[model samples]
Target: MSFKQLLYILLFFFTVSAKGSFILIPMDETTQQNHLKAYGITYWALDKQYKISWLLNYRGGSFLLPDAQEIRKECQIRGVSFEVLSDGESNSILDEISSPSQNMEAVVLERTPKIAVYTPKGKQPWDDAVTLVLTYAEIPFTPVYDEEVLSDGLLLYDWLHLHHEDFTGQYGKFFGAYKNAPWYIEQKKNAEALAAKLGYGKVSESKLA
Candidate 1:
């Protein structure tokens, strides 16, 4: 073949390859090439005439809500950070997940104290438990104490937890506890005051139970 013809063929091939070429670019802005900065492309395919939208990590259905795992997956896909949500009773799953990450000082911001205790017969336990636990765990908690429920010996700490003790001063039980115990009367007044102070409205023993 003539030299000019060979040169023309090479040019033709290069042109075609450039037109159909595929380039993978890093997603970060700092690392992307200058020319590609204004031309970044994310290609999504249309499956059918009608687009079917499916949740990336969540279960898209009735009668069920996506769990923490699904939430985590969705957060990753959407470039979002996730914070553990709790309703104040149980959070064992969060504890397990955070355990592994606990070693990283950067990720460990603040530790919230969780107070769990058993109520014994007739009275409340030590208020110092909160201070002691917080001192050791390096966490902060607001202790709750009631004069009606806890005698002078008892002290309020971290956050107050109402045991089987009836705040209504009713008795150990509800409606039943209120029927005759003087402690029940003082308990009701004290619980009301504490609830008001804590921004929770007055709740009866039944409501608490």
Candidate 2:
């Protein structure tokens, strides 16, 4: 059979036979091949309209997905580690999570959240590890700055990430050493301009406000 047809057939069988079963992708170091790829798989599943249960603090933040051959195939293709759990086993996991001793919790992901990163406009992914990982994993994020935040753009995103930012407005602690550096001078100028535009006397005031 053609690959497409075979995939459809396997999907049908998997959906029927694996009802109430789940695939768990643990984020522990045991998944050394590519722990990040597990997140990519979860994103892919979200794109496919699959609901995911994010098991926070469980096995180092794992994912629980309904059993599907397509998802399994994607995990294998991406080299993400996963395990299938029967209904009983899944319940046991929940039970353990409910116990007082565990720090586990769950969040249901019904849709892909809009992510925003607050960083300088001219900064590149190479300058920030979080941006690099998000870029490499094919995750989309909007880059926002002081202007955007002041304009209420922050309301548009479900998640926000900050990088290399000095909210204290001390110019990233470089004022005492690299104050004369061109890059530091530019950063200070930009921040001061923004602060002035926002009616603040100093960048630190604007940031703190």
The candidate maximizing TM-score is 2
By summed lDDT, the worst window of 10 consecutive residues in model 2 runs over: 30-39
All models: lDDT? 0.35, 0.86
Each candidate's clash count = 14, 0
- Per-model TM values vs. the true structure: 0.21, 0.70
Tell me how candidate 2 scores on lDDT.
0.86
State the number of backbone clashes in model 2.
0
**Top-scoring candidate (lDDT):** 2
At residue 146, give the lDDT of candidate 1.
42
Please provide, for model 1 over 39-158, each residue's C-alpha lDDT reduced to its tens digit, 9 standing for 90 to 100: 111111111121212212121110111223433453345443223323321134324334654431112112222443334333432434544443343333343344223343233333
Candidate 1 minimal-lDDT segment of 10 residues: 39-48
Per-residue alpha-carbon lDDT of candidate 2 for residues 1-209, written as tens digits (9 for 90 to 100) = 89999999999998876664799988988663577787888888998999999989888888999988899898888888898888889889888987889888888898888899988788888877888888877678898988888889899999999886778988786689999999889988988998999899999888887
Checking candidate 2 for backbone clashes, the offending pairs are none
